[model samples]
Target chain A: MDEVKIIEIKKSVFADNVKDADALRAELKEKKVFLLNLMSSPGSGKTTTLIQLINRIKDKTRISVMEADIDSDVDAVKIKESTGVSSIQLHTGGMCHLDAEMTRQGLDNLDLEETDLVILENVGNLVCPAEFDTGATCNAMILSVPEGDDKPLKYPLMFTVCDLVIINKMDVVPYFDFDLERCKKYIHLRNPQAQIIPISAKTGFGLDHLADWLLKQLP
Target chain B: MHELGIVFYIIRDVKKVAEENRVERVSEVVMDIGEVSTVVPHLLTHCWRWAADKEELLKGSELKCNIIPAVTWCDDCKQEYETVKHGKTCPHCHSENTWLLRGNEVEIRELVVSG
Candidate 1:
């Protein structure tokens, strides 16, 4: 039997994922747990920033982390050992971004109901993670001093999608030729409402302001 | 890249459709990608070539992408404008307070196969 046929159907595979993500967002909102999806390139101090944040806010707010990586539980193990925070490592296998399904699985694996604040550390890619919504209340993108200032313009999608832009590795800014003003201007051009905060996770500088911001967002 | 993952989704979805219709193989897949969706058509097609080559049902299948223009509505001027090229401040009133009308979409529109 020789047959040729065409089927026209407009369907979004991501539609189901988006629905699930919205449900997760509503659930988190009801629990008064503020969820933040942190995205950045590798070695941009995302883990370190989380470490500092966990250290500071551990006593204040019940903290938990869902670390997404392409293929590593090492970061999760380090986070667990250093901060003693309950963290679950999500291995995406080959997937670059963590979709809502993976996040739902992570939430199921970890006891999210007991936690007040949940931080989803997305895979070390700027582009894909920004497009995938993992049911977070807010999205935060970290740009370190060594990455330079032109990042916001070069990777406008990631910068524009984020609610907060954390300028990390401030301690090394003196050694690197990173222009702070240019970074701010670029980010503002992409998204005027983006909140900018500069900090050194190693030196524990500028963390208080971040902590305050997080606290204000909670409930 | 994420395009590889999206290609997987497309193939998987097409396979499901083929199975339901008792089709043996897929010949072509058409997708509508929004201009602002961040998924590059060239990258998607590249991934599609690699991914479809591995599957028997999708071998030598053609992947076609339609570019949908990014549009937004300016509340100040009550007019729609293109936002694909960036720096798209409203031409009428020069207001940046614009809501996106269309452009953030990525979906499978059609599938062709042999039954």
Candidate 2:
């Protein structure tokens, strides 16, 4: 009989995933497509904002969207109808966040060679989406005014991870008494480099600035 | 909430290592989780217990988590400081102009098995 030795292996499996994400990001950069992972809580107007951006920049750039949800292509359908751009729906089947693998798969489903902008509308949640890197060039977050000004402190990860923060639902600010200055201050406290954009997706207010910012990100 | 999906990654990695080393059963799995990684340790442990038990190699395995503190590098102060608790400002410069250096990671560090 031969004696066997069981040795423990110390390794990081996610290291490979990170490498893959990095490769995908390089490929996106080479293609000159600015990819943005848009994350926010449910009913924060991420879909509406996407629709507005699509309508605004449709003439200037070739836009494609990947919608990630627990279940439902409802938003994708709406985006397709409103924007008339190439869009795909990714059903995570209950996953709270969109991982790099899912984003890669979503990219495969679209023609990235021609896409000037690829926006990944991540699952409607503040926390998990911040943890998963989807190989996006930038992580954009939408924080509605109705969600309160303390959101940056309470959910610091979501706000801090974002390259840009859009304070949506400003049209309803008067009704909810949402302080725009306080929201900006809270976001700056977490991430000072984050660009804050206040807009109303309903009335298309302040969207021109958002459109210009999006265009500037493209190579 | 997505801890279950992460548990699958852990199990897959453990199984791959066990097979490569010709181990019959895995006894312990050690993981280093970052403080600001957005994964609740309790929820992850709960999900790991259920997910790992389903695999023969991981049955009865002890899952140990080492929590890493969040550290950030301040460009203005040119120093690194620990971000104690959540949403704590920089200690030295009191500057919010800081970037994360570490403690946002979630990875499997080591695994122990028996033949």
Measured by TM-score, the strongest candidate is 2
B1-115: candidate 2 lDDT, tens digit per residue: 7788788777877777778878787777888888877777898889989988888878888888889888888889898887664246577878767778878768777776667
At residue A162, candidate 1 shows an lDDT of 94
Q: State model 2's lDDT.
A: 0.85
Candidate 1: which docking quality band? medium
Q: Which segments of model 2 are wrong by more than 4 Å?
A: A1-13, B68-87, B90-105
TM-score, one value per model: 0.87, 0.88
C-alpha RMSD in Å of predicted model 1 compared with the true structure: 2.8
lDDT of 1: 0.87
**DockQ (CA atoms), all models:** 0.65, 0.48
Cα misplacement distance, residue B8 of candidate 1 (Å): 1.9
Q: List the residue pairs that clash in candidate 2.
A: none
Q: Against the true structure, whose lDDT is highest?
A: 1
Runs of candidate 1 exceeding 4 Å displacement: B19-24, B53-57, B69-104
Q: Chain B vs. true chain B: TM-score for each candidate?
A: 0.91, 0.90
Q: What share of the true interface contacts does each candidate keep?
A: 0.83, 0.53
